[model samples]
Target: MSASVPTVGSWHRLDRAGLQAVIDVLWLVGHRVVGPQVADGAIVIRDLRGVAELPTGWLDDQDGGSYRLRHDPVAGTFDHVVGPHSLKNFLFPARETIASFVQLNGSWSQTPPPAQVPPLAVLGVRGCDLAALAIQDRVFLGSGYVDEPYKSRREKLFLVAVNCRRAAATCFCHSMGSGPAAGPGFDLALTEIEGGFACEVGSERGAAVLAEAVAAGASIGGCSPEEVEAARGVPQALAARMHARQQGDGEPRPRSLDTHGIRDLLMTNLEHPRWDEVAARCLSCTNCTLVCPTCFCSSVQEVADLSGDHVDRERQWASCFSLDHARMHGHSVRSSTAARYRQWLTHKFAGWIDQFDTSGCTGCGRCITWCPVGIDVTEEIAAIRASGSGAAPPDGAAPAGAPEAGETAS
Candidate 1:
């Protein structure tokens, strides 16, 4: 095998054995490789020891509050859509101690997180999740205040994007304009075709990795023009199907979010009755916020040993749905469930744009599929739009016409 660094943007075809060589190459390069695999009856991102660990011949059928797996011998390894877990779980981990302080012998000590973290190579990254990474970049990196931990993990992340061949029922990336195809920010973007995968080298790192794979005996061959076009069509066809279905073009119920004036739509309709209606079904369980790719609400707490000698300050994922999310002086600002729900939705669609110049939601359908009660955000937004604006409820603290145009979060 000729070991050479594929130029950025080069196209090549990798057969099944060659694909495994790519994984082997990453492992040899000291990366902890992770990919999608069947676990607990769902396709979740997990550590991959080899290509066999991939969810081959397995397909996931996802819907509002429902996720099931099926086996298809002809299905590609990455045909399944996203599960509840995402890169957010790895990059911005569910919980971590940003800074820890210890006291003993009338002295105080401060310890920072370890700077050395193992590099990780993530495979089967859907375009929607890739878009989400950008959104988070704006928050943790682009934002004036940098979140060091998030940046550390993100910097070490090597993304392997997959051109989606199918979308789950709840998918609305077409409406959000986030996916159905891999965008920028990947090392290698793969399109699974008849005999193997067509790979596009996206970065210098990716090129170098391909070089290593070739040196390790991977079969990297140039793809013909027709084969490249066939590879490209995989994502294009999916996008077209979603677009047509979202337009109600002779299809059954379709999930979509209309973003035209979406900010003004939600900001002006705060007092709409849909809030109360959805809240009745809302479990306040934090499932939506947990699954959402860009929801960055967090909380910090201090831990002290019983001996009163050691203490640690930790931060964990938090949600606006929590009763104490906006608590100040032991009083919750959003005391009612309706108020909490309003805060999350408005922040995701409206306030986020104001803060980050982009909508927080990537329309990955994670929130909809993971919700126990199947309360779809797209449906709620449509209902609110249909109802126009409602008169402020009797117990409402804010006025109706201009009820909290922007949101304040912890």
Candidate 2:
């Protein structure tokens, strides 16, 4: 239970009983248990009650931004690929109230979400999701302003990050250098082994939780050194597999983009033709931002129950793609779809680095995979880069290496 990096510490066979025991320990300590479970025909994170709820043998088949659920008929166990949803939902909910207002006599009273956060144990969180968590932390709990609700809850959660043994076709975390193994931002890291599991305590809180489990008859037998080695190998092997799947023909060399000048690119390319091309294919449903792990833009709205006696204010997820998102002073800054798409991609890959000292994308590929038309971000960027110049000049302006409109490298 000590916070020592054990070459050989406690090893518990991670079977149904062992998993259930850990869950029980987490719950006993007032930690809410959340993990992957079969829902809506796909693996999704939900409130987990027991080991029976975990999707054991379910794997997923994904391609070009499409996903499907299928039985792992051969393994007889479902260790499915990561689903559309990430662990962000529980931490930064889709719909949350920052403050609420109510009418009391002739005055309006305001209330806010509780400052204190409940203990949470997020089980089966993938490496990509973990990376996403780190990015969100920068946005919500970073330097400029700390989001009260997010900051409070983030401090209380216990993360049990899982290595992705099976790579999803839609995943691009490796490109963004976020995953395939548990690095930082986790209290406990888990790797599922053949018979048992290899548990690595990542923090003092993790050690305490493991100690409680060990005390509760969670035996540390049958987890030999070889099992630990094997479990460790799985993550590395998975990483290689993920690397192989990344588009762009092998990994791009570690060359730093001049992110300092990226905002200029965004500002200059306002009238670039690529925006129109993307708009033609985009449904503008706002799915990309909704599933995006780092898109933190939100809007506040007031709701009144049918009784009309009370008004409750709520903060809901907002997307730049929404016309309402950019409305100001009876006019919208970006009413065109071309402008909307440009705003999103440029900020994510470029300006975000200035705003938060990190890239907005961890390359989880959720936005690409979840997009109805299969718009690949990598492909879009490649096209933009291949266009020669960042943007074309207006009217009779001379070409500054900008490609002709509708021209793309085949």
Candidate 3:
């Protein structure tokens, strides 16, 4: 058992026993282990009893408007891509109560919830999702907001990031300049090699796990230099194949729209023709921002028992696509679909950088794939740019596009 930090030298190969041994040790340390397992016709995160419970041979297929589960057949011998759910659920959960207030005998008092049990190990997180977590760290932790729940969950997390051996059609982390390999931010990274798993320790917790598992001989053994290169080459090869098939050429760089002018553009385009086009297809489902790791918007709800003896205030996820999200004094600022859509798009690609000094979009493409109506964000941006340049909407087309949305444009 060897321990090293984020660099490549810290890598070791772990056989099945070694992997299981590490899981056992982490569990002993009071860490709740979570990973993808096959359930309900899809791969979802759940508690793992051992390596066997983790999804083996399970893979997912995603596109602009589709998702499906497929069997890899290779089973344990694969590095699966990140599933629809990322580590955010564990950290910034879908909803949580901060505290509750109660009135008793004409006196008001507050009851605070107990601290959360830190989820110890999150196994099989992909590199892109790892990057997304990093981005969220900047949003929730680094920001002055200091989301208390997110901070608590992050402090206890033991990340096990995996490189992408394959990418779904909708995946574009490579284009967004985020993935193909585990960069920084994970406690450990695993790459599926020929016979076992190539593991790299990225933190002290990861090193301790490696140390506990070493007596079991899960570490990689004598391999020709070529074999090591071959094992490491898998992710890069997979990335290249994905790039070849994607619609656009090279990386889909974030569109460098005029930042100085964007606020005015968004402010002015409230009633633009594109709004009507997009509204037709946008079910007003908040899937895009919901799946977006950087989207930190949330709403609070309070629950109380009939006795009024106990009450709880819960903060849950919110979406810009929802009418109530922008509501003020019984009216929403972005009341219409066109206004809401434009607000989200401009904020993501344009104003986010101006406000945060970093691009909000990592281009994970979750929005493109999860949308039930198949609204392509990239295509919409292209359409907006076209409309701005005096290219009229396609022969009575809606703001988003034609009534029929295509797979993805080149």
Candidate 4:
């Protein structure tokens, strides 16, 4: 596949087959293409061999603590919004072996694991997740101490972002200023319409991939002006439909959070009683952090062979909800569920700003949709604000006898 120089800012139209052609070109260039697919009764990001693997014509119904996959053959393949998984799962694996050890003659030696980084091309990356990726990049790359594994994988990643046509019931990216439209950091972006994809290139790699697709006859040509106009209008139309859905009775909904002030709001309300109220409902199952695309807390575990001759040290995802997470000098600082939940919320919305110069949340709403108890962060913040309790309490001021927060009820 070949083509002349592509116009940098132009939008091109690639039909369904043209989209598949791009995937094929990616495979030819040694990229392990991954995208959204129907699996385990939900749309999930996974390794895809071809375009047929996409969850085409499937729509997802997501709300607090609930999700249902419905078939809508009439709808485009990219119609649904995000799912349980995020780009982090692939970039920063949940559990990974960092080192291995061998024991001989009562002496042990450690060696770093072999690098297994592979080229990856991710399709259908949502805007919020892209923002989260940038946050993760800051944590693992921008920070003075770099995560080598993350850097290796990140260097090889090729991102193809997609703008959302419709907002999920739990979505609040608009409030967070993270997305609805693809933002910076992607290689290529796509907006799906009735006949084909309206594509934009964000990098040289994206241009190369798109040129290959065009050369292979995957795209007819540059998008027509009318098609470009239509593509630009899809998001607005979807936003209106979402508004109607959210305001079924034509009643006004609560105003969105003033995210600009969220840092101060959370920092000042450290001892708000609303924390207790939310703690009552929060399972502390760590679903929020797990589903979160930017939560990077982890713990190291050591494993030994049955013969005790070999050992491996692995890094696994950890959650603040766990009692051991706050253990210090034989005492848990956040002994109460309220305190643990407070730590998570504060760290995400407040402390992160001080630490990373950015908010931890991208407002994808995965936490609300996947929580077993349906604990909504936006609602919790609203409740705290409504209480009008912004004064910070003295140290160690959490209420007594509060239940411990974990995956299960105490």
Per-candidate clash tally: 0, 8, 7, 0
Residues 56-118 of candidate 2 have per-residue lDDT tens digits of 778876655577887765542335756767767777888887776667677877765555656
Least well predicted 10-residue stretch by lDDT in candidate 4: 401-410
Kindly list the per-residue Cα lDDT of model 3 for residues 1-410, writing each as its tens digit: 23322233467766777678878777877889888887877677788769888777777766666667878687553444555677777777888887888889978799766667756688888766676777677778776778777788888888877877877666766655566666677777778876677776678777776766664444534334565577678788976776666535533332211122333344445567887898888888888887776787889998888987777898999888898998999999988887788778877765664565455665567787688887877677656656664333333332341111111100
**TM-score top scorer:** 1
Worst 10 residues of 3 by lDDT: 401-410
Task: For candidate 4, write residues 288-401 as lDDT tens digits.
Answer: 889899999999999888998988888999999998898899998899999999999989887887777778888788988899998888778777766645522322233332
Q: What is the C-alpha lDDT of each candidate?
A: 0.84, 0.70, 0.68, 0.79
Q: Give lDDT: candidate 1, residue 8.
A: 88
Task: Report the Cα lDDT for candidate 2.
Answer: 0.70
Q: Which regions of candidate 1 deviate over 4 angstroms?
A: 1-5, 248-252, 305-307, 389-410
Highest lDDT: give the candidate number. Answer: 1
Instruction: State the lDDT of candidate 1 residue by residue for 1-410, as single tens digits.
Output: 22234878888889879889999889888999999989999888888978888888998887778888999988888888999899998888888878877776799998766566788999999888988999899999997999988887788889889999998889988777778888889999999988889998999999899888988888798777787788899899999988877767432256877666667778888888888999999999999999888888889888778987767778889999998799999999999899999999999988887888788888899999899998899889877766676423323454332223212111
Q: Judge candidate 2 at residue 182 and give its lDDT.
A: 63
Candidates 2 and 4 compared by TM-score, better number: 4
- Once superposed on the true structure, which residue ranges of model 3 sit more than 4 Å away at CA? 1-9, 75-79, 215-228, 247-272, 385-410
Residue pairs clashing, model 3 = 13-220, 57-75, 274-399, 277-398, 277-399, 277-400, 278-400
